[model samples]
Target: MLRPELIEFSLDNQKAELKIVPNLHGPITEDDLLQLLALPDFSYLCPLHAVITQAVIQVNQLHPQDEGNIELFFEIAERRDAEISFEIASDKMQASMALTAAYGGKSLGLRDVLQNLKLQRISMGLSKAKIEALLVEFATLSPGEKCHSVIANGRAAVNGSPAKLERKVSLARERLLQPQHNSDGTVDMRNLGAIIMVKPGNLLIEKHPATQGVNGYNVYGETLIAKPGKDLKFTAGNGTEFAANNPNQLIATVAGQPVETPSGMQVDDVLQIKNVDVGYGHVDFKGSVLITGDVGEGMVVKSHGDITVMGFVDSATLEAKGDITVSKGVIGRQLKDLSLSTKLIAQGQISAQFVQYSQLKAKGNILVTKQLLHSHTQTQQQLIVSDASARRGDLVGGKAEANKGIKAVAIGATADTKTELFCAMELTELKQQLKQLDQSIKSMVVAGLNIEAQLRKLPPKEQWQADAMMVEQVKVMLEEKRRTVVFRTQEELEFEALKLEIEGYYKHYRIDALKHVFSNVELHVGTAFQRTQREHGPCQISNKNQEIRFDYSH
Candidate 1:
């Protein structure tokens, strides 16, 4: 028998070879060869098992000179487990697969790789051509190299769009619809923020329908339903109607100013004119009035709706049930005209560039773009004097009252311009009325007591003989007095409750002066008042603990 030690094993880069030394002492047998292969150290060279089996079978026929010289047993190429890893992007819009080279096993082909993918249940959006190409390329790749390719793609769903509505409508009959510019390149804000007017049957709004969205496909070939676009119906408000031909088209039913509201669009009757001169007379209209030119001195313009003056208003009486906007300043004669009162009254807001020597009142806010000089202005809401570009936008020689508050760039000019700002006047008035009601109630109580004493002094029904009618009259008077006292008492209670409500609102009252407040400026919050004899700057005034306090800290 041949010794197992005579067999030697060696390995190259990828080849395993074996050599055997000739054993002259005993002839080599198949059992001897099989015993040599069973050595534990040869297990790492298992790829050469088939070749070793053949060599063992031929060992008995080998000559001594053959000597089992070094021969290739097996090609030991690298063996790698077939890998197919998948990757998906965060947005789920794409997917990829990575293939590491598979060597030394049954040769990996396209069918094998695809079969493995199918077994892994990769059914959605599979690119067969791409997978085959990747497999072919992977076949050419060297050992230790990897291949990556996008395998599946997902489509994004298209979102729906909203309907478009016309924002602006043309008013060809009305001039000054847009602001005019002077030759010197300065914009004439006189026509700025102009009202849009529409005649009967004129188009006011045109609605465009929403567009339908396209459907999308996902990587799994699943249909992704897109959201349908929203549709809106025209909400026709007062004095508006939809066109007979087109439901989406809105038209004015009356010749008026077009106003946009949350519910719908409306047209209020509008009176348009070139100027308010002597020819225009004392214009009194039941609707809105638009003046393209100046309102001449002593002209009176009254309207149930808004009044817009594109030019200056000089010594005119302008009253409106709605808002009043004067592009230019309201200028009164420097010499106070006792006969003609220069006033501007509005149920809504009043906005003007400036006001001088005029009286203005509004139920809503009063906005002054420039100075408010020697004017008596009052509003139920705020009084604001805001001139952003001016160095000084002061309230000089004016008594300004507002129910809420007053905000001004400056209070009183540098020369001690005596400006008085009164805030929360409604509450103050309520309090005063409550006090008066209390006094009236007390008077009524005393009157009732006097009447009761008179009634008691009257003779009883059994003793009354001569003046029964007089006693009856006295009794009736006493009953009436009692009823009057009760009514007055109830009124007093109601007024007291109202006064409490007003006080709550008064607590939020504030007077803000953004810039300097000169001497002789009076600040009043409810009934509390403070006169600044010395200059104080950039402060807010409010009533705190029955005292008027000024906060100088910004």
Candidate 2:
């Protein structure tokens, strides 16, 4: 086997600086210094700048232009700095050391000392005893060495990866010990490492026990909770399968507990997760939301199509033109309490949960759901929006008028008016009246003829008096009935006018129209579900009591 290299040292600025030489008379190169920085098993031996520069010059391979570059000068100054960092992170230390050395004052004899080392391959002119001491102090001279602490950084890795470095490993005390973990109860030596990293399979936590590492973790439930950590519990849990929350920090997995996954679902046209531990601020996605897990507070989710939640949503607004389905129940905000849209369909109802929408309809009646309380009319058409439960920022549903006068049901504050008044005259009633009128007209015709005949039969005075009384009474009754028919026609026209207005304002919207487009579109002012009793403050999140259905029109 090849012999290990030895190093020497000196004391300056309360730090021991090492000095080393090749076993041969050759000078060290940049590549040789790089190898020293990456040697994981042995400690490092860094020569003073004065020694390295002298050796470079002696080789006659030093670039003349290198001395003129400002960067080069700064680098040279950093190497000569009085401060010495005992860190193995050579890449990280290079910049720091350079800055420190550039500003540090140098001893007056640096040039003379450099020239002396240049003439010979001696150990910076230090005694062998001092050199040996430095080896012990720096730990580079040992047959084996190990560092307990590790620092991981992109810059620290320099031009390569930290994992791929060569290391000198120590033999274990026993040939083998128990396996770290095994469901099969057998050993797997394939996973062995010089440094065994301990990872917990799971932790059997106290039932509702207080979380040790974080606050708000006092156990109220059987399972251990991470307590809404700064990094989202669900976001990291789903977004990346393999992610390190605390860089360079070991992750301890608790047994039988699901770790937090960060999903990439967009919410309310805003809020997107850029990475495992990072999310874009208040973003908008017009197409689809693809989050891996739950959405945090105050986020808004809007979709043109259907909405799919991989996890839960807390105190967040969700809006969609099509359909909505959440894998888990919503929390932090009430569905029935908030002013949500009226046009919505969910497999579930808002029961102790948030039920905000413009108009909402479930397959079943709502007992605990607040949106279904105090409905305007639930029988005439299909669904009637409740009046008692909807809160501020809620939009209204469209209306369908059949028997209960005009009721506005859908969003956009529209109404539908359906009237059953048609002069209160059935064909039988009108036909009967017409028969009487016809009889009166026929009798009048006969009376006039009889008067003509009588005039010929008797004296002129008697004939005239009898004709006047009979014709006058009949004329009065006939005129009264005609006036009644005319009045009924006018009333019928008025009802028709109101009905036309319902169809005219089909899709027209005003004031935050995007927020309140009722689904049914057919609305009746006096008949449909209207917020007429109270003006719905500005349209926001809501679920209407009456679901606007598109059955038919006219």
Candidate 3:
């Protein structure tokens, strides 16, 4: 029997050694060597079994008693293949790269990794410092451990800003009507309303050009172009012109009030006054009018451009073709019945601090800061009665109409003020215009028929062969009448089409009311009307199925 201690194996089982100790009984034989090798457990070394067996045979043939130990079998360990992987991503603006360390292979140096990356064609945005750090980390990691690191990154381009325009013109002073505090902590109403007047050739606006943006660099060190800034052209409207020296500067041409509009800037011929009282008399200016003081009772102020009153408006009439802005409130005081007899009419918008016992109408929007009490207000667009702070925003009115919508913080008072609100009212003016157009079209059709009948009464062209001069004159007259008939027919067609379009626009009218609505409120949408007996909040009234419906969900 072979002793187990006769052969020795390494920990990894890659090599086997046989001990050649001097035997006390007999010399070692080939069978004894094979038995000793087999006893040491060489199953894991099956791939190298032939070499191991040959080595054992050589050892048996030598049988040197002097040699204490001999290497009987050896096998070189096989390793897993070295693997390298990378992650790359990029967009139009930036790019990035990451690296994953190779596993189960010989230790890699910085140079070796760099060579491998180069051979793999990853030359863009390579960071030497990051590569060195990854190599250092790779050197410290144990076998089968992975090291992942971000290697490269690219920068993004910057976009340019658009050109800006700044207006330097001033209009009426926008002053809040809060009580002024004195040194003794007493409050008083100190009117701060003032009119801003400008002379001719005054600077109205200035334009600043856009700036160029910076370019960017990609991972491959390629230049990325940046979007250039957009330029703006100066729009000088009526009564305004560009400066002679600088095109970016705008200057007023005539001495008037500077008005800023959506299309451009204009200077309206103005009529500036201290007040509209008995001494100053009523005013009806061709252009805009700026009153620095109040319009006393029984006075009128009318303008073609705009009417800007810097003080309170008494029981008077204010009319304008553009807009009407009253710095203070409109009060109809000392009236017999306290009805809203003071009228305010504007083709554009009407903005006021407060309106009480007054009648106001505008083709555009109506913006009130405080409240509308017992007044009648109508607007073609939205009606907004709220400040940014949402304080004193109440609409306890008699009647109000807004074709677009109405927005307020509170609708009625706690006493349940009877407020009548109408939205998307029927386009009566357009409908009337369409009716008149239809009448005109009918009249034109009749006229066209009459002209055709007159043209048909003329002699035929074949009769001209007998009398050339008479035929020529009659033919000219007939041709003129025929042209009139054709033109009238075209006009009739155009008018009919316009009437249809207006009818379609009137059919799709809608309105909405934001915030709370109280009791005793009558709402009218189109031709339908609804009265609320109980208070409903955050509701919207619209015309549906030829009936007024209230929607409280939103």
Residue 185 CA error for candidate 2 (Å)?
A: 33
- By TM-score, the best candidate is 3
Ten-residue segment with the worst summed lDDT in candidate 3? 71-80
In the range 291-397, model 3's lDDT, one tens digit per residue, is 87899999999987778887889899999877788888888743577556689998878888888989999988888878888888889888878765555578985
Q: Any runs in candidate 1 off by more than 4 Å, and if so which?
A: 1-194, 198-238, 241-255, 259-266, 334-340, 388-392, 428-507
Put down candidate 1 lDDT per residue, 1-554, tens digits, no spaces: 55555655443333334454333423345455555545565432234445655655544344444564423232222234456677767665677888876433344677766676666555567787888888888888764468989987777777466566784564321222245677899867554654567788888887787666777766645677665455555688667898899987888898788654433466778788889988879999886788888898889999876788878899889998777888777898555454324789987778887888888999888888778898888888898887544354668886889888988888887788788888876665677777887787788878888888877787676677457687678778867887986576466556655666766764567888888788898888877888998887788888887678888887
Best lDDT goes to which candidate? 1
lDDT of 2: 0.30
List the global CA lDDT of all models.
0.71, 0.30, 0.69
Error of 3 at 267 (Å): 3.4
Show the lowest summed lDDT stretch of 10 residues, model 1: 70-79
